[model samples]
Target: MNGRISLRGLRAKGHHGVYDFERADGQDFVVDVVLELDLSRAAVSDDVADTVHYGELATALVGVLTGEPVNLIETLADRLLTVCLADERVETAEVTVHKPQAPIPHDFADVAVTLRRSRL
Candidate 1:
């Protein structure tokens, strides 16, 4: 009865860091979201209405990512989790925000933040 909807590696350019250069020039961010919900109706009816619309979710995420300036990926992830959990059908959500080109001087692959939330 449980189903998951996932959107991965969504690319966006936004200002999300501490440094002036980071905030001014902006950078590319990757976002991934997973939503858990009941899928029995969708399974039985074979209709899109019974399931979460991932395209709409993605569009909403893009709006959040580009709409405001955040200082941390953790904040971005929290925002995404909030957006996902706003859906009535969703019981739980997991959001990950990735910063590939971090401004760190040391060699590193990437930095990311992940957060989980459930309907109360």
Candidate 2:
């Protein structure tokens, strides 16, 4: 009955960096989320109510991503994790925030922060 829902490459524009220009010219942040929960109820009842509404989840995440300006991606990741674990049905959640346009001197493909949390 255990199940997993994964959402990847959720892109949103936000001003979340240390530099002033970064705040002025917002950049896109990509988030990937994985949620673990019991699917038995949803599977048997065929009700969206029994399972996490991923579409609504995406909207909530984007709201956080674009909501406030933070100095670190770590803070952003933590905020996203809070949103991920909001539902009681979600036993565990993992979030990865990717900053592809990070201001790095050397050439880099990406910079990301990944955090995982579970209910106590």
Candidate 3:
């Protein structure tokens, strides 16, 4: 009964960077999460209570993105991972934070940090 839930492209404006201007100006952060858990109860009961409510999880994650100031996308990714693991049902979680507006001299498509955690 193991199941996986994926959430992608959760965006929010965040003041997070090593540079003062970058923090002050803020930038959009995109998050993608994969949650692993048992889905047997939810599958049989047909109730959201039996599984992680992704909509609610998204709101909480956005709050984290917009609420705090961090110096690295790695930290942001860790914070997002923490949120994903808040649900006891989640046995493992993977979070990826994309910083599309990263301050780089050369042309780059994106900069991102991906973190994975498990409760064992």
Per-candidate Cα lDDT values, in order, are 0.89, 0.96, 0.95
Higher-TM-score candidate among 2 and 3? 3
Q: Write the per-residue lDDT of candidate 3 for residues 47-78, one digit (tens) a residue.
A: 99999999999999999999889999999999
Question: In each prediction, how many residue pairs overlap at the backbone (N, C-alpha, C within less than 3 A)?
Answer: 0, 0, 0
The TM-score of predicted model 2 comes to 0.97
What local lDDT score does residue 41 receive in model 3, on the 0 to 100 scale?
A: 97
Overall local distance difference test of candidate 2: 0.96
Q: Which stretches of candidate 3 lie over 4 Å from their true place?
A: none
Arrange candidates, best lDDT first.
2, 3, 1
Please, what are the lDDT tens digits per residue for candidate 2 over residues 1-120? 999999999999999999999999999999999999999999999999999999999999999999989999999999999999999999999999999999899999889999999996
Model 2 misplaced stretches (Cα beyond 4 Å): none
TM accuracy, model 1 = 0.94
Candidate 3 has a TM-score of: 0.98
What TM-scores do the predictions have?
0.94, 0.97, 0.98
Lowest lDDT 10-mer window, candidate 3?
A: 67-76
